[model samples]
Target: MQNYKKDFPIFKNNPSLIFLDSTSSTQKPEYVIEWICDYLSQSYSNIHRGLYDIAINSEKMYFDSKQKVADFLGTHDLKEIIYTYNSNYALNIISQTLRLNKVLKTGDKVLVSIVEHHSNIVPWLILKEEIGIELEFVRVTQDFDIDFDDFEKKYDEKVKVIAFTHVSNVTGKIFDVERIGKLKRPDTLFIIDASQSFPHMKLDVPKMNCDFLFFTAHKVMADSWLGVIWGKRELLEKYKPIFSGWWAINEVKKECFKPGALPFKFEPGTPNISGALSLLKALEYIEKIGWYETVESIEKELIEYSLEQFRSRPYLQLIGNTESKKRVWVFWFYIQGVHALDIADAMAENNICIRAGHHCTEPFMNYLKLSSSARMSLYIYNSKDDIDAFFKILDTNFNPTWLTK
Candidate 1:
């Protein structure tokens, strides 16, 4: 498999750094970095609320980027796209908007999967606390797959929303979202958290038939603190403005607020113009690199090879689905008698980066009866050598499993 290692500039600058924590955030490619620098240097101004050349150019760039995002995602509607600080912020806005607008009422139940990231869980928990909405969880099976039976059992007439992750960041198991979407009741709104899957797979909004989807740009090979909320236009229109400031103007007299159009109503305040442009570049970069199929094939080979080597390690214990077909390139496990942090520190000492601890999915960890674990997540840039280096770092009595060439 061809490894496009040179596409990322960080490798040229810091040649020894092996980035295995792509699940957390990926290294920016040369294209994205250059686009950011060029955009900031040439045109740096606030978007909209102004008519000067700089402002007009910035707003055009910003809106054009939104259109590009919608096009990239294969969505039919551009008006449904709303950008936020990150995925957590998007989910919080959806939950809050639903509540503040009284679309989701007290005593309504929302079903969430146990495998969700904390971003998916905490917002609903807050809703339950602040608005008296009941929270329900779909269970995870022994292999870390979402229990469809439990998910079905939790559904009822009172369940207004079904929130879930399309893929587990810790386990790398892809949820059967289309099948789950079929279980929605007449009034049930399906909210998908695609923070993990969006980067690695192809998604079609109408095909998925979800009311709302949440994903962050960082995890998809872009910069930080940028998120996307893809809501059905009708659902977005139902959103009540939480921050009533300069943008949320309805009445001229006392400034009693009515919501603005599709996106701006929810995304009030000054926008992250650079973040949006960079994300657009990231999408272009991914497309330029052959998108999901090419990346998926390469990473699958890397993980399969890595899993074989992992099976030989006596101290290392593999978590979730051991077979490569059931998961992505992410592997999480605990070594006997070695703290996850210690392993992480050792890896860091060897100039490799990996994630350790609950991974912001403590509920899933709790479900598995684990305090913590370490993760080595791969991406398009990762190679078999990176996995070999990680394994070599893990063992004190290192044996060469790699080709000298």
Candidate 2:
């Protein structure tokens, strides 16, 4: 695994550094950076603009990267994939598509869990206000898993869609997509925010039984600010792009213009050629390293070991279930005599960076009765020693002021 660490240039000189905030973003690998540089330097040209050699070659590279993403996601139809600025943009696109198709309306309701990131929850709120649809929330257990019995009770015909995170960014709880998939109705669409899970865990949308899904490329060690949205062909076909640009149309006729079909209809402007190229290289990097095996080893060695260290600590409270199978490495916890922000700052002083805040799940924080918590999320580059050093810092610090606050 240490040999694999060599591929990530960010970890090379920063051997003493600890990075545990992969939920926010991840460090890029050397190959992805090189791939982007090569594209911008050598193959730089606008795609689908001209038949000239460079333009044609650039178009090939851009579309080829899309095909690579499709393959990585295990989709049969390349047209089913749509590129967006980020996961948030992708979710907005879906919400717009749903509105345009009238799949969302005054009487319709959209179901989401209480633990959703803002990317998943905010869009639904906007839709509810704009289109007059109702928003419904599923409950979570004390240990942070979905209350399935409550979810089943909330299931009904008025619910037009159900969207949830595959894994919580703060609690690191992994949702059983299979269970949610089983609740699909004819009119109900199932969407999964795979931002945290797709990068680390093995993913198969068809197997997960989702109707629409999106995840960012950079989170998975791919290109920055690029993401992929996967949707069933039929549902997307019914949507007219809300922000349609000239590029989204098939042709500008002598009289007027007409929109392209399916995926092309959603891509509304000049594409990110360099980012797409880098994403391809990142997917290739994951393939070479073996995605499944990497995830498995990290869970066993780092995630489980870290949990074992604090599981029995009286002054510390783990926010989610420690069972490796039910969680990812994106875990959060609190110490009795510590402010989350202070702990994070102390860790940063030692060159260890973790995240501390509501983590964009303010509603969940309210539910937990916690103002904030410190999160130590893991990626492939993190080692057991990193976890060891972080815990050592926690043990060495005890601030009485934290408890009084």
What is the overall TM-score of model 2 with all chains considered together?
0.94
Each candidate structure's count of clashing pairs:
0, 0
Error of model 1, residue 197, in angstroms = 0.7
In model 1, which runs have C-alpha deviations exceeding 4 angstroms? 248-252, 397-405
**Alpha carbon deviation, residue 67, candidate 1 (Å):** 1.5
lDDT of 1 by residue, 185-231 (tens): 66889999999888888887777779999899998777888899988
- Per residue, candidate 2 scores C-alpha lDDT tens digits across 1-405 of 443567787888787677878889988889888777877787688887888988998888777777877776677677898888899999998997888878788879999999999889889899888988888889999888999998988888899899999998888888998789987877789999999888877777778788998999889787777888988887778777777776789888788778887667888888776777777788788878776676667666777788887785566777887676678887788877568999899999999999998999998898778987888887878887888888878777743344356
**After superposition, which runs of candidate 2 have C-alpha atoms over 4 Å from their true positions?**
1-3, 253-256, 399-405
In model 1, the Cα lDDT at residue 84 comes to: 91
Candidate 1 differs from the real structure by a C-alpha RMSD in angstroms, to one decimal, of 3.0
lDDT for every model? Answer: 0.84, 0.82
